[model samples]
Each structure stands twice: as structure tokens, then as C-alpha cells.
Target: MNEDKNRIVSHGAFVVRYRAAGAYRFEAHSHPYLTVTSVMSGMLEAEIGSSHLVAAPEESLFTNSFQSHSGNGSDLEFVSVGITAEAVAEAAINAGFTKAGADIAFNNSYSSDRSVAEIARAIAAEVLSEEPGRNAMLDALISQLVIVLLRSHLRVKRSPLIELSRAGPVDRRLRRAMEFMHDNYSRDLGIEEIAQAAYLSEYHFARLFRRVTGVTPHAYLANLRLEQARELLINTGESISDIAGAVGYQSQSHFTKAFKAVTGLTPKSYREGTTRAVEPAEAGKAGLESSNKVSSGE
Candidate 1:
């Protein structure tokens, strides 16, 4: 895939474009760019790692950097606009979302005929016009697209079935224990160490931890390690033994057992299950090297 060809138009910081033709099949790939696709006149299906969704005319989708997926249009007219990943991250931070997890992957299919057709017409008008402030015009249109999709996305409300009005003594202790566990999951951890981290006796900490998170501290640690291991397995070429050690498992077998227990697949199997190659333009720009530095507090 040609990164330059993928980039349609760059307005200040955001790049925008549309897709209409081409076969509906692409290998799994990732980029350091942000992507927002507005289905103009046909249906498109996308696979993000293990997740899948479909978008119809006037519907939209958003993806963040290094997201692995493949897509194709069902009919002829399918197009999408993309922005750089850095811009989206900056927007997320501005929106007060700190731990901006993975890319925001979602899709919306139009249920009402009139609405879908109207949005498609609107998109076509915008794409064809060479009016002044066209870039800004596209930005506004994309923003509206995001709003429409988000309004359709389902968000489950926290259960009112159980409520905690105030932090009880047990709750306070458990909260502390959870914080310690999150901060120390990469290290060689123990129940005793975690209890001490929370200033609680071992027995009390173990019981309370289970009550809050629905899992024992040790079990929770194992889950965290597995998640970290999976991330490394998919994103990096680190050896299995090294990844196991880095995430706190002393033995490769132990890590493999726990990983399979949680994810239902061995580490190697999970990695190979979705072997997405990066596009050359994206790969060339990859890495974490910083060109400039500034001094911190004295």
C-alpha cells in the first residue's frame, strides 16, 4: 500500500479523502495515522483485529494509530477520509481523556432511508465543491459525522442494583490494594507484598480484593500479566521467553498456561492469528525517537 496515495488532502494537520472504487479486500495493516471513513453511497465492512463492523451510506467510522484491519466496499461507491493519528491523540487529550487506550473503533449503519440519502447527498456536495475554506468545511462535516455515529453507539449504564454511597473501611483498603496491584503488576508480586502495599493483613486484603474486583489479587495479577503479554506479542517481535519474563512470569510454561487460561489461545497462536503487516510509509515513520528536548523543573 502506498502511504502517499492513501493521503488525499492535508488541511493544516488533518488529512481528508474519500474512497469509491477498488476490490473490497486488503491484508491486515496498521498505520501511525488516524482514519475516519464516511460511507458515501454503498456498504463497507471492516475488521479491526478480532472486532468487526459494517458501515452503510452516510455512516462513519473512526480508528486510531496502529490499528490493524482490512476492508472493502460491497458495491462500487465507497469512500473514506483519514486524519493523522497525532492529531486525534491531541484532540483526545484536549477532551480530558488521559489514558486514551487503543484506537476508537466503531461503525454506524443507517436505519432510516431519508436520513441516509440526505447525508450522502450532503457528503457529495462537500466533496465536489471548490469553495473557500473547503478544508474547514470538510472538518465540520466530519465532526458532524462523528456526532451522529456516537449518538447511535450503545453505552451500558452502571447497575443501580448495587451502590456504594461512601467508601467503607474495607472499600478504602481494597482500593489501595487495587492501586498497588496496577502499579506493580510488571514486577515479581506476591499477596503478602500487595497486603503490605495496602497496609492490610494478608487474609483481610485477599478477601476484600476479591469482593471488589471479582477476583483474588493473585488472579487479577495473572490477568494483567496476560493482557500485557498479548499486547507485546501482537505489537512487537519480542521473543516469547523475554515477554514472559518482562511481565513477571518466571517460567515460559507458567506464562503460556496463564495466557491460554484467560485468552483461550497460546501466546504464539494469538500473535499469528492476526499477522497484520504495516504499510511501508507507516513503517518508515514508526519508532519513538524524539528530535528535540526541553528542561524540566529544578
Candidate 2:
């Protein structure tokens, strides 16, 4: 959305996202790249396949490429590094798993390695500063994360012997309802309309949806909207008022209140914290200035 090239830092083979604080949920989804999320504070509740995981501070979670996983955070600060599959393969080869590159995966979703946690924080620091060599620092950090995973946690990819199922008409209805919520989260959505999408009455829909998701439809939609707003704040130069409207909130004040309640930071503060970066020429100039100071022995 934000066409400003400065807002985005290009890491050649990885994508990095950071959240300073928030309650957020990602509905069931899969990606072609592997993801490692390190939680620096609070907790992350997630579901990977049939496994439910809770990662607290100093813990990291791994999701292999194409693994269907979903997670929600509770007042957390985290950095998630998304590594391209090709990068993983190359890393695996360099780790002496040359024949196993195609088979590399994580059998488990949870890790408590301190190196992973520290590297995650380093990546976050690099993201927030305009320090010289920021891009190079990020690339090296990403490579460190990958190396840690390959050395300490790599597993062979394999097919499950049996499939787990939640199959039934009710499950189908609930999924349809979730799909509707996801598709139209940018607009004001109501219970009645959402119920119709699931082919259920409003009363039953409210009850069943909560039972299935452990959260009400309204809560789910709000989380989805706030997550979108968070991304806009981090990656775009849009005003807070504009972001509120884009995420379906009619009032800027209301959006600010809700955002602070969940994230522990105002929208403006969050944006300011996440978008700091130095242009190459400016960084070079700053380095030169520092060198001049050192030469003068001041």
C-alpha cells in the first residue's frame, strides 16, 4: 500500500516482521517459505496440525514450509523470520545435509534455544535502527537463525501415517463462516450477515463459532482488523486516522483506544518505533563523520 521504498527493507532471501506488542491472530494458513517466530515477551498460542503449542518469552516456534498453522498472540513482542525454501535448501547443503536439503523440516513446533532468542532480538534491533550496515547485519542474522535450526532442530520431511480429521457438516459451516470473516474483515461486518454466510441462525452461529474458535465472531473480526492495521502501521506511511478507516473503524479515537489496550503502545508510537532505517548514502556519510571524530581523537 505504501509506495515509499524507505518503508521496506529488502533482505535478499528472507522476510522479517516484528510486532512490538499486540493481541493478534493468524487464521489457518500455509506458506511456501519456512517461518521462525521468537517471542521476547508475553505468549503465543498456536496450532500446528494437531499440536497445540504455547511459546512464552525466550522461546521460539518453527513452522515448516507449507504446514498449515495458525497462532494468536497475547500482549507480545516478537520477531518472525520467513526464510525462502531455496535459502533453506542452500543452508542445509552447507550444513553437510547435501542429500537431505529437500527433506529438511522441523518435526516439532517448539524450541527454547537461547541463541535463537538472542538472534531474534538482534534482528529486531537491526530493523529498528538506522545503523550503518543494517541490511548486511539483517542478512547475517537471518543466516544465523537458519544455521541454528539446521544444526539443532532439522528433521526429515515425511508424510503422516494417518490423517487427522474434524470432518462434519458443522465444521464445514464454521469454516465457511471463518472464510467470510476473513474475506470481508476490511469492512464493517455484522453477526446476522456472518451467520447467513455459515447457513446458521444468529443465535446458533454465535454459540457454535465461539465453541469452535475459543473466541467470539466479534473478537475474531476485531483481531483480524487490528492485525491488518498493525501491518499498515509498520509497512506504510499512512496516517493513523486513515489506517483506522481502512480497517473498518469509523472513529480514530476508538481505534487508538483499542490499539493501545491490546498493544501497550499508541498507533503513532508503534509506527515510529518500527520504521527507522538509514539510506545508504546517509549511512556512509555518518560513518565518515564518526571516522573523522576518531581520527581527531576527540
lDDT of 1: 0.50
lDDT to native, each model: 0.50, 0.67
Error of 1 at 105 (Å): 20
TM-score of each: 0.39, 0.53
Using lDDT as the measure, which candidate wins?
Answer: 2
Model 2 CA deviation exceeding 4 Å by range:
1-12, 156-298
Model 2: what TM-score? 0.53
Candidate 1 lDDT over 151-180, as tens digits, reads 443121222222221221124445566567
Per-residue lDDT over 24-63 for candidate 2, one digit per residue giving the tens place of the 0 to 100 score: 6666644445788888788889897678999999899898
Tell me model 2's lDDT, rounded to 2 decimals: 0.67
Model 1, residue 235: distance off in Å is 1.4
TM-score for candidate 1: 0.39
Task: Provide the lowest-lDDT 10-residue window in model 2.
Answer: 289-298
